[model samples]
Target: MRRLAPLILWALACSAAAAADVSGRVSTAADGVNVVPLAEGSVIEVVLTTSGGEQVRTFAARDGAFALAGVPAGRHVVSAYNSRFVFPEVHVDVTASGVQAAALVFNGAPIPASPLVIRPAGVAQYYEARKAVDVVGFIKTPYGLMIAFSVFAMVVMPMMKVDPEEYREAMSSLRGGDGGGAVEQSGGGGRSGGGGARSGGGMQPTGAGAQRRQIRDR
Candidate 1:
């Protein structure tokens, strides 16, 4: 039993060292080379998916560092997530020796010299920004100017006061004179009896001329 005790102890030690710990940092790149850690109040979630579809999750600390302890020896994919930035998945291989992390893959292209430092490919925009209305710019447009003129006429025309009689007189004067002037000229010609009497005599053919012609024929 004493000889077998050393063998059992060695087996337990080997089993304990079989599982390794995976550690990495979450960072953001401004120019695609140098990386900076995430903000202090930011929450970053790191996920490790094993080859057998098992997942191990952990949150990054304030300094953007995270660790998953006792990960089984196998191949796994590491991904980091945040609300404002997009990150790429990293491939990692775990053995009894140590953890080996692959370079980050962004947009299907692997970044060179990139190790466990996870950086964002781009910023995530959830909503569009609201723009202010430009009053001057709108008024400069043809449609906007037309709308403004119509509104001005609507507002100002109601406030103006004008007498109906005065409006009618002014309109008649502007139209060359009062409408009664034409009627008055016709009445004056009738009263004068010069042109009116000649026109009446020419229109009546069965009067004195017709009677004289009948007497001569007899």
Candidate 2:
């Protein structure tokens, strides 16, 4: 047991020397100095990624402060995550001495004076709200007007009543005003004791001889 005790102590010391603690504050400012007011129930997740593909995650406090203990000494990257906001990846160097804050980058460009501060670049919008329909405004458009006219023709016009005599008179007046034709009647001489009638200008007999013949036949 005594021989194993020395080996256990040496192993513990080496492990302690290899790991370090990384501490920083995640703020809404680029300089990591000014702290912004966060929304209620807002939670920011701080992640520490080592060069060896190891990751350690923790939540930031209400004041945006975070700490990851027992992180292996090496070059590492610190980043913040949230659904509502976008965060830039921060490069941090962790050694046996302490955690050294480095440049924070966004889109390959270094942000000046922004060390550990993780401000959101912009708000993320996953969905768009539907717009409410405006009946009056729609009716003012050309398509809407066309639809309204179609509805009026299909629904309202059929429900209306018209007198046959009035419709015939209106049609006759329209035709006469346009010089469409004239109605002519022969003297009463047909077998039915009624005058023979012809309609339309071109359909009637033109010459005097044809007129006399038509009259005699009638």
Candidate 3:
């Protein structure tokens, strides 16, 4: 019975030590030093890879902090992502006592005492989601295309109108002159009328000419 008691006590201690926590805060690094919490109502998820299998835990951040309890102790790779962007992977060697402090930053700053792992999954998922959003936002549906075309017509189409100088030259060429064909015809008519008036005056014999001929006969 004494030997059995010692064995049981050792087993319980081992069990308790093996079950440790992995917890941390998620933040955005600004100016490489200032830290800001993620947007309100955003989703936070952590992916932990263990020898047994991959474990995923998702939770809403409260005051920009998250905690995973009872994480199996081992060498685990931690990958975290949100609806908008993903943080770089954090690698931690989980021992009998677990990783109690972990910080994931999106700002590309160095974290002290934290193993930074290369991103293999979170970045791919983030880009895929962003691509899906861009596709839907631009040309995924008829309405989206319609909106795009409408914007083009309203903003860009007006800029494509004929140039003012080119337009004036085209109209002048079509009319055959700068003042148009009508002005040419009107000017020709005025010249012809002047010639006719001079001829008519000569044919009528002016009064001065008649008076001079009568005085010469006297």
Q: 1-218 in candidate 2: lDDT tens per residue?
A: 99999999999999899898777776665444554566678899999898999899999998777888889877778888876667778777677766664666445444322235556665657889888999999999999999999999999897686778888888988768534332222222442342324334445546667989889999
The pairs that clash in candidate 1 are none
Candidate 3: RMSD to truth: 11.4
What overall lDDT goes with each candidate model? 0.78, 0.73, 0.64
lDDT of 1 by residue, 1-218 (tens): 99999999998888778978777777767457766555557799999998889899999887677888878888778898987788878777787655754655444444332236776778877989998999999999999999999998999776576788888888988987756798899889778898778889887886878889999999
Better of 1 and 2 by lDDT: 1
- Predicted candidate 2, C-alpha RMSD: 14.8
| lDDT at position 52, candidate 3 | 70
TM, every model: 0.47, 0.48, 0.40
Candidate 3 lDDT, tens digit per residue, 76-141?
Answer: 666766665556776566665656333343443435433222232222242333433476656868
Off by more than 4 A, model 3 = 1-13, 34-40, 100-110, 113-218
Count of steric clashes across candidates, in order: 0, 0, 0
Assess candidate 1 and give its lDDT.
0.78
